[model samples]
Target: MPVPATGRLQWTDVPTPLRARLEDALDAPVTDTNTPAGGFGHQLAAALTLRGGRRVFVKAAPDADPLTAANVHEAAVLQALPPGAPAPSLLGVHRASRWTAVVIAHLDGPHPDLSPASTDAEQTWALLDKLTSSPAPAPYRAAVSATPSTAASLHGWAELAADPPADLPAAARDRLQQLAELETAWPALACGDRIVHGDLRADNMVRDHHHGVTFVDWAHATTGPACIDAASLAPQLVLAGHTPEDVADLLRDHPATATSPETTTAFLTALTGHWHRNARKPAPPGAPGLRAYQHRAAAAGLALLSHRLS
Candidate 1:
């Protein structure tokens, strides 16, 4: 399933004054703009080509909201990235009464497909393999782990066991008690010292023609279990229309994830619950399609679990 850019802001939506300011921060005149797709819930996402033939990726949000801090966090982390980091370089940042934007060197690549047996899948798996070998830089290590707070976001099964949603699947609704029990152990299981991309998925990554694989969206960067990021690939592969069995085969060569079935199941349960819960909520300011995406993601998580548990 393709993630939509349904509600994210377009380059044309930016006010003229603010656009001029961004160009000023870049110390270059903006010559063209392209809104990159795969905007899960980002408020602003686009690539601005500079007068000097440079292209920079930009992500921004309305200055008054929760995402305001996240956009700033990305800029800080991007700027502080250590040598040999797998991410792009931060070029500049801008904040005003209306919004905040962070600019980084644009990665010229195509988004990797998560579907099984494709070249994109192989490339993505290979990239995750490489990420498992590289330790998070000192700056990334200091950044918070997304697992604990993310764990707090899981409310579906518990809420359903008490007050079920009308659209909840019969299988899921019937297994609420099991889900509630299984969900409790994920946070402890996810704890570790490596930097997990925390939000690993095809959308947050790209395969560069030259660099091979490059990651975007650093706001979720954190230190956690070495396999945490790799563990996420299975569910995402399912979402990309692969079966859970195919995902299992994909994991055979993935040591970071293959070594622990218990941990993976726990991770999948917690993540499924998170998406299931959030999907039922009101859409955020700029993410109309997010709930729909979450619903699909939750289904994938659930499917992956069924196969793994069987």
Candidate 2:
């Protein structure tokens, strides 16, 4: 299935003052703007062609928006990445008139399709191998900790089991108590020394022809088990039309996901529960498509978990 597009702010929708500041930061006049599709969608994300034909990607948010802090964090993460990391280079960060924007050198490519047998999957997995083997940079390790963050964000099965929702599937509801217990295992299982792109779905990656796969959106980056990022690829593979059994087998065979069987099942359960709970909430402002996307992802995740547990 195609990733949903979270409706975003257009270039024309930006205030004139902020636009001028952005252009000044680029040191050029913007000649064209193209908004990319399929992200969390609470900011201004565009591919810009400048006066000298330089192309760059930019994401801007109001100073008051949560995305503003995310962009700031992402800028810091990008700056700290080692030269060989498969991510974009941060060009500059600009802020003015209650808005913040980060500029990045653009990589040309489409988001990878992770269906079984696709070359995109091969390239993406190769990229993950490189990413997971490298230790987090010193500066990044000092700033962000993955354990507490994962513990805080990856809770849902326990909460859901406490008060099961009306829409909860029979597969999960039947095994709710078991799942609630299992979901608690990821924080320990995810503990490691490698850099983890906490969110590693297709939409968060671009398959550059020359670069293999280039990761984007670093707000969730942290140091943890390489398998944390590697395991994230399973549900996305299911979403791309692979069977749950196949995805499970692939994860087992992948070097990065060398954890025990219990660890893999626990992480998948926690991830499914996270999306299952979030998918029921009201859509955030400017991201009407997010809930639907989450709902689909939750279903895909649940399917994989069901197979694993079975």
Candidate 3:
């Protein structure tokens, strides 16, 4: 039921006119193309050698229609970012027909393993802190407030307790039920209007020799509780084999991340529960890796909850 992690779209997939616009934006003929080394999206970073041997990264998405506005918003957000922020520079935005392409200065660096040594944890926290602290633009804040939370996300643990995947362990199923019951006790926490990179997994970050870290994939950017972003990071941390001590260390050093442990456990439990439910469905995108990561997070959440209940 799980799908393989499909890589990014190819340059050949671009329409003829869109390609021309891209070439015009760069003022260079695309000498060669290199597949971007990450997740499924309509994004590509090609190594383009211009007529004069200048190189830049060219990225193309679609124009402002209902389907493509997210890309436009991403470009706008990147453009508005404070100078000296580690993010890439937005070179230009061009529109042709239904397609829109945003060009950024090519970053040369190594992709650091998401799970770096403890020495690198400070840098990681700093990057997350900067991102979480940035003010959300008015339009982005409005859009996130308007978009409703996914039904599955809102009631994930309840749904899982009613009918869990056959593959999930009995202990995991029991934890789901407990989490569902616990959800009733907490008030619906208001997120207020904080800016968050809705998805900030390890694969989305690239570390430059000079610039430190630059996060890519702004498509999932949204305005929400800072905790949700912290919650999102937990799964990745667990998958990387971080211990409870590691998590505690992160929270200890970064007080803003120190949400109530019970609340964080419940939130992460629901997230993993949702992933498990989706993984069992037929032809689910990212089901394989999603299921794997869900199990890891579920295990970590159960451990935390056990400590809280004791």
Candidate 4:
């Protein structure tokens, strides 16, 4: 994943009143804070060291910020995760001085290396298995409909085909109509009730040496086909230096992707279209590197989709 261009806010940058309120809510005094790099947004994500030597992960954003809602949603999803789910436990959600914060158990580890020959890939599969093994909780099923939430974003191929962009990649231009058709197949094929980490990627997972892989970032969690999470990993695997064909073969044999090959093809095509179209737009308000990252990811997705199409 590309390092976010806009640097994250330091803990000290958080308003004093808000920080005080956060500490009060946690019932602990903050002694120190550490902010890590490499995320997609410009949110305040830090690990706080409490007075009693306890550590917790906190992510906060202004009420007006888009991420504020996401933080709130994440807190709810984490709270609703069933027992034994490979995810962090939600500690609390604090809102003060027009800022929103979601705190969770601190997970100490680095993002998994998804390159070929790495055990991290297998660990990710294991996590996916455990995650989808059970039905989505009642709260999530009532609050989120996975297919409709993402269908609009994934329909970009149809729009691009109608009025192709000048900077559209050569490979996509040659098969624009075919891709447009394939992109429409996901809605029908993605019907299921399993909870999926809708945005599964290397950066969204942390590999704890002792505990294996732990999934993070539940903001995009949704109820969909068992394969959604596994399909989301294909482009990332390609980005990690595996050939598109190899990623396809690996996913084909995985239990999560037990659906027809067409399902994976359509999902990847729609996903590629989303990135390709979005990458050409202006950068988002707080994420300068987002479009550039999308451009690179779109290339990877296109390569993966092309192989599947052939």
TM-score-best of 3 and 4: 4
**Superposition error at 114 for model 1 (Å):** 2.3
Lowest lDDT sum, 10 consecutive residues, model 3, at 1-10
Candidate 2, residues 225-292, lDDT tens digits: the string is: 77777778888988999888888888887777765567667777888889998898877666777788
* Residue 181 error, candidate 4, Å: 1.0
TM-score of each: 0.86, 0.91, 0.79, 0.91
- Please provide, for model 1 over 190-256, each residue's C-alpha lDDT reduced to its tens digit, 9 standing for 90 to 100: 6666656667778888777777677788776666666667767778888888877888666654867
Off by over 4 Å in 4: 1-5, 143-148
Per-prediction RMSD in angstroms?
3.8, 3.7, 4.2, 3.1
Candidates' lDDT values, in order? 0.72, 0.80, 0.59, 0.80
- The TM-score that candidate 3 achieves is 0.79
Per-residue alpha-carbon lDDT of candidate 4 for residues 154-225, written as tens digits (9 for 90 to 100) = 767999999999988888999999999988877777667788778887878888766668888888877777
> How many clashes does each candidate structure show, in the order listed?
0, 0, 2, 0
Residue by residue across 45-94, what tens digits does model 3's lDDT show?
A: 46556677676666664443332565566676667655555578778877
